[model samples]
Every structure is written in C-alpha cells, then in structure tokens.
Target: MNILHHAVLVKSVNITSVAKLLLDNLLRHVREHVASIGSLSTMTVATLLDPRFKTLGFLSRNKVQEAVRRLKSECTALIASSEASLPHPSDAGESTNNSSELWCLLDETVDQKRQSFNATADAILEVEQYLVEVNLRRHQDPLEYWHKQKHVYPYLYHMSQRFLCSPASSVPCKSVFSKAGRSSANEETAYNHKQ
Candidate 1:
C-alpha cells in the first residue's frame, strides 16, 4: 500500500528518463493489478489472523475493521455448517442398536454441549482474544503457532487450515523488487556500454 501510494504521488523532474519511465509503469501496473484493497479481503483476513503480521500490513483502521468483519462472517458460517453436519441427540440413539449406558451418557453430554453453544459470541470472543495477544516473533512460523493454538481457537484453526495453506498469489510482492533490481542492473550495464 505504501509503495503504491508513493508511486502514484511521486513527481520529480530531475530524475533520469529511465527512472521516470519505471515509475510511470509501476503506477500503471499497480492500478491494473490492485484496483483496491477490498478486492483482497481473503488475503487481508489471513494477514489479520497471522500472529506476526496481524495489523502491520494494513493501511487504515477502516480496512482493518473490514477484514475483521469478513473473518467473523466466514467463521460463523463455518461453525454453522459444521454444526449442521453433526448427528443430533435424538439421531444418535437411532444409529446405534445398543441401548447401553455409555451411549446414554454420550447423548446427554452432547445435548448439554449443544445447549451451551453460542457461535456468534464465541467467534467474537476468540477473534478479540487473538487480536489482544502479543504478536509472534518475526522469524516464528505462523503455521507452527496456529498448530499450537488449535485447541485455544478451534474454529480459527479450521479456518486457518483453509486460508494459510496456500499463498494469496503465485507471485509474491518481494519478487517484484527483485525483478526491479535486475532491470536496474541491466540499465547500468547498458549505460556503461554507451560510455
């Protein structure tokens, strides 16, 4: 976001023709690729959940709220869908021919758990708790962190499995700067040849 903002607003007449051309192309490409942060909600939410870069990459408070809302929406949906798939208390007896004491106890436990379940409140609390915690070290592995936190935030653990496994894009942003370095080196080599 900073790079895009700087690229668009930057203007200087003293720069070489090559630099001016590069800056123009960067702005054009940024516009072509990223219309707005809204388009990357999945990436944004994933970053918000990341222990290391939770709020670092965001540009504004509004964007942070937007991403958090998106995550909450998805979290509730996931919890609802999973709950819907579970065998109901009454259905449990029908599935098993044995009317043993163990099955009866299990059904009672399931019923009690179901009665206490509050998906919305739990989701909000878990998300808030996650945000309140200190960020993990920069070098720490987020997957490892999430793995250890699986029991602490069960729904988020499942959601992270869905979001964090794959990257937002095949081409990461760091590679763009690497490509620019090569282009600058080429320009330097050509300039030396001209002399």
Candidate 2:
C-alpha cells in the first residue's frame, strides 16, 4: 500500500523522462493486475482480522463491511448445520417422564442449541468490536492478538485460520535462491582470500 501510494504521489521533476515513462507503465500494470485489494474476500477478511490493518487499512469501506457480513453469515450457517446434525434428546426414548433426568436432558439440548446461535452472534460482535478499537502497532504480530483472544472469540479465530495460512507476500521466498547463491559466493571468496 505504501509503495503504490508513494509511486503515484511522490513524483518530482528530478525524475528523468525514462524513469517517468517506467513509473507510468508500472502504475498501469498495477492498476490492471493488483489494484483492488478487496477483490478477494478471503484476502480482505484476512487483512481485516490483522491487528495492523483491521478495517482501517481497507481501500474500500464497503468491501470491508461486505466481507465481514459474509463471514458472519457463514458462521451462522455453520452453527445451524452443526446443530441440525446433533441427535435429539427426545430421539433417545419416546417415553415421557416427569423425572428430573428428562428435564435435565431437555434443558441441556436447549442450551446447546442456544449456545450455538449465541456463539455465532458473539463472533460477529467480536468483529464489530475489533473494528471499533484502535489499530494495533504495525510492528505487533496480528496472529499473537488472535492467539491471545482465541478463547474469547473462537468463531472469528477459526474463520481466520484458513486465511491466515495463506502467504501475505512471496518476495522473501522468491529471493531465497538468489540469497543462497550470494552467500555461497561470499563464502568461496572469503576462503580464497585466506589461502
């Protein structure tokens, strides 16, 4: 984001004609291929969940809201599906007893179902709360925030898991071979100097 911002906004007359042309071409390519940060819902959500970015880093506010809404709906659907898969307490036996055991069983079933819905609601609430809070320091690890608050916001944390696993930037990995080659050459040169 900073790179793109500076690329366009920081132009000076000191730049040569060739460099200006190159900058324009680069901007064109970036606009064509890498302009919209919110195009991918997963990426946008991941950025939103990042402590450094949150909703504040979004280029488009509408996209941030859309991603959050999508996540909330997905969480609600997951809760509903899991609740549907559970065996009903009444299915255990057709016998209706006024016994405390029956009441306890029924109460447990209701509580479980309610808790599922409440969990989803809480997850959405957590996101909303996070959005309102001050952005964390850029140097702080966003995953650490997620880890510390996982118990408090399990649903959001779980939703963020898949997105978090994705590579944020491939530059480091891409440069590994070049870095290795440079280091090996330096080591060989040092060995020759000692000979």
Q: In candidate 1, which residue pairs clash?
A: none
Off by over 4 Å in 1: 1-38, 90-117, 168-195
lDDT (Cα, tens digit) per residue for candidate 1, span 118-174? 666677888888888998886888899999999999999888888875443323354
In model 2, the number of clashes is 0
TM-score of each: 0.60, 0.59
Worst 10 residues of 1 by lDDT: 166-175
RMSD to the hidden true structure, all candidates: 7.8, 9.2
Going through the candidates in order, what is the number of backbone clashes in each?
0, 0
lDDT of 2 at 141: 79
**Which 10-residue window in model 2 sums to the lowest lDDT?**
168-177
Candidate 2: global Cα-lDDT? 0.64
